[model samples]
Target: MSNFVFVLDTNKQPLDPIHPGQARRLLSSKKAAVYRRYPFTIILKHLSLEPNSTPSQIKIDPGAKVTGLALLQGDKVIWGAELTHRGFAIRDALLTRGSFRRGRRSRKTRYRQARFLNRTRPQGWLPPSLLSRVENILTWVKRLIKFCPVSSIVSELVRFNTQLMQDPTRQKEGYQQGTLYQYEVREYVLEKWGRKCAYCGVKNVPLEVEHIHPRSRGGSNRPSNLTLACVPCNQAKGNQDIRDFLSSKPDLLKRILSQAKRPLADAAAVNSTRYALLNALKKLGLPVTTGTGGQTKYNRAVQGVSKTHWHDAALVGETPQLQFLTNNPLLITAKGHGVRQRVITDKYGLPKQHRGRFKLSHGFKTGDIVKASIPKGKYAGHYDGLRIAIRTKPSFALYPKNGGKQFDTHCKYLNTIHKADGFAFSFVGGDSSSA
Candidate 1:
């Protein structure tokens, strides 16, 4: 299965999305034409159609780094995408700017007034790092709703249970008597050990459920006795006592034993902004339903699907018995518009050089997407971006958008397709030309 192809009537009015096969038939018979590449939309050439649509739902699994999105009509998943955000990038950029500013202030300069508590954050204000994730999801949702007739939206508001995850039996018999079951113990042990061998700490190795105390030597099958060890470590340990084996590294053994009894803390930092996202989605005026991380995991386990963001999205929120989903989802990386104003600077905040102007000599901005066609020149294909190193009248070098090969072309044959709206374009396994 693949994404549903968007359809439009001859008058350019929106219509119901059809299967990719149907869209192919229409295109082959010259009944429809390609409209967009990223979303794979199509438009009718001569056929007149009414504005009718089927009830559809959009499911979003929001996360700090990667968000999963899926559009479904009943039990069939028509389109799916994994949106990778640049939250860390935003954070790192701000930190770098702050470091530069601090360095500049410390250098030999006139004394300035000491600031004290002058800045204040507005209501509902979130750091750019966290807010970027919410905005990216919202932007995609808005764009999708415009193309498809989405009736309802489903999103994962809270991923994990903070209390239950931190102390699995917090409500039960308190800390000392709270013991996890065998299966639960294994999961907790793996996480506590960082999914690595407790003996060697080598990650990415196949780990085995090993007993810290030899089971033959009266070691109970409790979580405290259970630990993760690689195949070599388990074989070497055999039935030997753990104390005798790890006598050289008392600290490592003690750390492993202590951590096995304690549960890993929930990621409260990343989940802090989930409520803001939920409220923003609700403001869209759609009937929104929220799910939990446990429910999503249960749904995926019951369906026996492999772990992936898009698969989790398909399994989220009132899933049917049988659902059709795409094998390859569209990969969307949210690269924000290059908004860096600083031109050049050395490592120690010393200014090396600066850009004289923002626009190129040919009047094209740095991020504008342009198409260039040269009848007889070195460069002839489509190129985008404002990497015009030589802005001479005859030809100019163009850096391609979405990490493409840069090429040189003449300005006379350049045509503007879509102006860069503070965003970059990079897609794979879809149509390339624009409408």
Candidate 2:
């Protein structure tokens, strides 16, 4: 099933989201018109005397790479989206800019005095990369609120205890230190073992936390005793000692033993901005609730729900028996608004080409979603995707959403579908309900 479409009244007041079929019928009868294309919102032509909008709650599962969003009306998930943040992109951009500045200074050019320890950061300061993740999540929260009647926010305020994983007895508080004990151990093992099967050296497969020294054979629950192995490998080496398991391959056995003993310093690449995210959500003045990773995992496990980011989100906190109404979720990738640099620079910081002051050409801008129809040519066809502007030129690049070859097309043949908002959109389908 696809996500439900958001609806709005004549005054632009948020209303209950309707199924896509209902939305199509409303548009066919000329009762509603398209309001926004990105979130697929429809606006009624006439004002409603009584708005029958059901209050929805936004549940977020924030991660380092992607943040899952689910709009839950009661126990049913109506709309779902997975937002991919570009934090690493921002970090790389900053690094490149700094390198360019430093290179220019070292080229025997006239340089300004070095400034150090002069700028003081405000309280709760975060690196730009980390801050971008929070900002990306917050931006979607505001957008969803505007398009849907969000009554409350639920966020997974989870962190990892690297110290606990390394030394479980160091803190006697017993696993409830942000994440579940088993999950912490599994996470640490995955990092230390490079997320590959320790037995077969296989990668990208689901791994099980296998004891190197068999637990049945008196292996203690230490981080050094845990390793990861693929399902097939684990089953094949069931309860076998590490040395016995890899007796034929003595070299591989030695390597695994040595690596498992070496402690990993940063096993928990936890999202440091989880509390910052919580604080920001609290400032929204809505009833905000938080859940732990352990709680989320328990909720998901008891329901036997298949693990997807959006599925995890729906089971965030105080969840009832959930009903999955949609299997396909909107995929949103945060592509920041174009940079402000006018003079394009080369590796040596030399000016290569100057960019135009205006980004629009014939009422169309870069990143705007457009539908194009070309009568006849090598690239002749109908296309619907974001337009890549060819500065001051009449032709723009058309990137089809259906994995078609990209080609340049004339602006006259294009129709605007959705204005760009610093995000790329798509969709993916998978079963998120119980297996």
Candidate 3:
């Protein structure tokens, strides 16, 4: 067979803490933008499991471990490996440069035109025009900071738009980044609890996701069957009398009873691309800021007028109306950081957990930890009235933050000891019984 090798940069540490397939995952992450700290020379190996030695012997692909060789070449190979499989994508894989042009039919142009067209009449969007004209008109006259000049602004604006307009091609790669996303999910699982059985809370960073219901026995990636477990845990829970993975961990089962049990707060930011937008904005030399999103403005006149007139209505010149960077750019959450609050309640409104017994949608097992909230009663201070519970969810869902810390309205129910007023009970099955 044949092999492919790579010489990676010496800077980046092991990103995911796992061994094999590290390079594929790393390069797949943060696409197009290279991680300067970590670089690598990939080695691809073309091999056949059955050595029939003929033209029709066989051909291999990415998922086939036997067909690929993922090596950690700090300097030399600890174990012998010559070839690597075709694991596409790298941190620095540049998008083929093209003339970025603005056409009447393009999405950016459509939004800009729509914004300008929408201005013909107000959609009751402007809260109080009378108040706006009164306050903003006066504000604009008093504070006139000296930028280079409008001529300079106009010139720069022209240059930027000209550059943006250079790209004319309209072909969608549709960007099938699933392979990369798959790698990320694997890394997240391994890094969270090592290689131990997730149900039993055993650490085995090297463990793989064992199907509690193996495909051979009729299982899909529906989540319940898929669990993090060592090779041995997987083997032990084989087909014969395979019970649910949750039965293994007492802590995970208990989270349901110990939790505040309320709705979630606003959305959190987690995707790596928003960070890309943040960085790109800074590199463009704008007084870049992190934020969720806000009402979009277009007119060269109104947009300019709004920022100059109002503080909250920020001014983004003729640069990239970067709304395209995000999937849901229209729903602007906040200006600085796109943090969303779910449902915040005053302490007076919070519900008290029943002291004696409580039940959860899920049950409590072992290896559970109880987290409590600081009660508002006499023991509120110094965690005196603190009550703990186990987590019930298999895995919690959290959004990524654009900047600072993003707190949710519903977050009072999670990652905290508190819960909403209507919510009763105090138990979480995850790591709580053990906690």
Candidate 4:
């Protein structure tokens, strides 16, 4: 089913979200007008007699890369959205800018006086990349509150409990003793290797903890040095180095080594921001509820719902028998409203093109979603996409949503659908749960 439509009163107060069919009828009967295209909102022509709406709760499943949001009314999920953050993109941009500045410093500012290290960060400082994830989630939560009668918040606070695992900071003597240690290591390895034999990539078999570097050869009992292997594979590679065991399969050997060295960056990012997100939600004055990843998984499995970010969100905390009102979720990617740099430069810091002070041209700004109708040309047809760039001339560059080649379309043929909001929106998975 399609997502429910957000509705607003004539006074601009948020009303209860209604089904898409009801919204379509209201629009067709001239009782309501389109208020927002991205969220599919409508405004009533008359003020709502009952401005106070039935209290709905906002459920969130915050992740490292994407955060899922769902609007729950009673036991039914009315609207859903998956927000994709630009953490890596932000980091890359900052790195590029730093490189440019460093190059200039080395080339011409060698004699410049060094600056004092006087900068002090406040308590609870986060890197810009990680901070952006929290901000993106908060932005959407506030926006959803403005469009729905959100009275409470529910969030998945912990993806996995690090306390249950081995603490790298602890001394070897401080490690948990006996079965607890074995349990922690086994659980961690199962998750890391997908509960399969890491050597043969075989699943649904009895697997044993195998060492990458054999214990007899001075290998440490660190989690990174451990992997899963079936009985035969374990026996075959017993007391042998992983390199020697997988000598014939160089590619698999390399992959295993690389994966073993891979740090839990994604998990760390989520853990770092969980408390910040919780604090932000509490500041909203709503009764915030929290759940763990295990609880969410159980809730979803009990209901037989397909695994997806939004689905997990809808089943986050103390969930009842859920009735899904929508299978399609609005996909939102955080494409920050262009950059502040006026001049576009190349790798060597040479200016290539300068941006106009004013982005508007022919009554349209860059990033505005538009529908273009071409009467006749190489690209002669109706197209729907974003206006990536605007020209002083009549023609503008249009990037099609359906992966078509970006072509310039005249101002007369373009109709604005949605204004630039630093986000690109689309819908996916109407008949299924994978959105």
- Name the candidate that leads on lDDT: 4
- How many clashing pairs per prediction, in order? 0, 0, 110, 0
Runs in model 2 deviating more than 4 A are 110-113, 159-179, 187-196, 203-206, 211-225, 231-270, 347-351, 429-435
> How high is each candidate's TM-score?
0.75, 0.84, 0.23, 0.83
Off by over 4 Å in 4: 109-114, 162-241, 376-380, 385-388, 429-435
Residue-wise lDDT of candidate 3 within 224-316, one digit each (tens)? Answer: 234576677667767643435446655664542222132111111112122322333344332432221111123223434322111112222
lDDT by residue for model 4 (130-209), tens: 89999999988998889888889999887655344435665553553332455445655776777899889899889999
Model 1 clash number? 0
- Tell me the TM-score of model 1: 0.75
Report each candidate's C-alpha RMSD, comma-separated, in the order given. Answer: 5.7, 5.1, 27.3, 4.6
Scored against the true structure, residue 399 in model 3 reaches a CA lDDT of 22
Ranking of models by lDDT:
4, 2, 1, 3
lDDT to native, each model: 0.71, 0.81, 0.26, 0.83
State in Å the error of residue 7, model 3. Answer: 32
Model 2: which residue pairs collide? none
lDDT of 4: 0.83
**What are the per-residue Cα lDDT tens digits for candidate 1 across 41-93?**
88888756357888888899887777888888888887888888888888888
**Candidate 3: stretches off by over 4 Å:** 1-182, 191-196, 222-225, 240-268, 272-283, 286-435
